[model samples]
Target: MPANTAPIKWAQRSDSLYVTISLPDVKSESITLTDDKLVFTGTSGANEYACDFEFFKGCDAEKSTYKVLPRSVQMFIVKAEEEEEEFWPRLLKDKAKEKNQVKIDWDKYVDEDEEEEAGGFDTSGLEGGQGMGGMPGMGGMGGPGGPGGGMGGMPPGMDMEALMAQMGGMGGMPGMGGEGGMGGMEEMMAKMKGDLENKGGDEGEDSDDDDLPDLEES
Candidate 1:
């Protein structure tokens, strides 16, 4: 009997491709990689699992790496072209081949712009940049706050303006005020209070003016 074909999940960046085979506790693993093809065979207890892929573009097989985890085998294959900076439209040379067995790895997917931003923070010896590190979500969560110009770890969907209105004041959060201090919050709260008090005083003055209206015509 033939070995069972393993399921694969893949995602990619401009320079590399990620391939994961879902085979638990694989032993006697054999991986054959070339510029265009990858063949893998392994045994999990009595069951044999295998998979093969003909890549859409040339790859650097010698520089590629793989590790067998408790539940799967993960491969990181580097692209061959020195100037490659675009994602391949399809993973395989034959577009429809093994379509049912392969699927996108959405959790690992990063858009081109996000990848570039992540690349900018890469250190000399860091493996695959900070974005691709073990804590992948850290790159998307921007400096001291949420991603894409949010305030102080605020929930993405919360409307700050509405929230302040409900609370009956407009107060500046820390760091949102001038150069990071409690000063902004203090000023904002004071301004709100002063406005309310002044409005009441103006109403009282208007009532006094109404009582003295007899000299208005003179």
Candidate 2:
């Protein structure tokens, strides 16, 4: 499964670096921070998001902290050495990889469970003796409903199993999985995009406004 790519906004202060990523609905417990990297998974609107950052400047992960907001996450990372003065040219020291983890909410942060679950469909009304009435108006005859209700009038056969399986496959597509897998796809795309950009850079492509420039120690 591809991880969702999350866009980031960051700034450096004398004491710390503030890194924020748009994530309206994130799996809070999914957030992880270490001396070298940071990672998390989340969603916004109809799309999903994810991010993995490997820092160039060493950071004190123990002193770092983050807050999950209604639509974003704000993180603070303390400098490894208070006296050192330097700023990062880019958010990551190297190409990022999607290393995803548990996606439970803060309240259920300790639980090990699936991030998404199907609410389950209701078929009781859809399963009486009339049994689905042959594609709506096709209920030709036989029962009080007419030929549309008859056994011979019924379609060849309702392969519920096959149909359900096919539907499940569709649900697994991007933006489809009740809520899980689709979110990760964004991360995959983001990573691929980053790779392409880096490749172009390797080929001597000109840098643009989109590329972050080196910062002078202040």
Candidate 3:
């Protein structure tokens, strides 16, 4: 009698999908998923193997629903090809050699000295009386609080006017007395306090002013 071939068996569960193919020998090679298909490569000893047919194409569809198992099926056997050696390793070696042949430009790297030369910085003006503060808190000369008073004990080399000007111009801060200036906060607080005091003093001031008549000849 001819050797009976069994069909491959497959099963699907909530967490996983499985497929089994049988070879003639009990010790076949491992199976793998390649290009979304299951590939069974037999190892050195296997000539043929057999697995259940229900896993292959055209099994009972109604029996294999989401919750249930399909009808029982017989096994099928497939002949295994002899394993081919040395093919994969040589292919990888050639690919690596091809990749290493690619050239990269070393000239693209920038030198540190060249980068510094390209950056513009001048130190000529940073000399002599050029040092900050001819006096305390008064940079250069003729700073605030008049000559020699030196900004009333403020730090040396500190110039309030230049600092304010630089802050206003470069940092987009408001001018000294503008609406958004620091002066606005002080002026607002002073006005609030004056208004509150005037409310209490209003009646007394009115009475005193009324009691005093305009100057007339007696």
TM-score of each: 0.52, 0.40, 0.17
Clashes by residue pair, model 1: none
Distance from true location, Cα of 26 in model 1, Å: 0.7
lDDT to native, each model: 0.68, 0.53, 0.32
Per-model C-alpha RMSD: 12.7, 32.9, 32.9
lDDT of 2 by residue, 1-218 (tens): 67567767665544456566756765633676777777677667766677666776677766555556667676656667856655444556763331232221232121112322422222222221121212222111233233244353443454646544555566545564336454455467788999999998877856575488788999
Per-residue lDDT tens digits of candidate 1, residues 1-218?
99998888888888888878878898998887788998989998799988887988888765665667778877777778775468888788876774767888886777776887655212122222122212212233332322332555455566967656544343335465564344566577789999999999988778555677566665
Candidate 2's clash total is: 17
Q: Which 10 consecutive positions of candidate 2 have the poorest summed lDDT?
A: 131-140
lDDT of 2 at 68: 62
Which RMSD does model 1 reach against the true structure?
12.7
Candidate 2 lDDT for residue 23? 62
Task: Write the residue-wise lDDT of candidate 3 on 1-218 in tens digits.
Answer: 32233333332222122233333333433332221223233322324432111222122221111101122211111111224311111111234432332122122222334544433212122111111112221123333443344544454566987665655555434664466575564466788999989997986567666778799989
Best by TM-score: 1
| TM-score, cand. 1 vs. native | 0.52
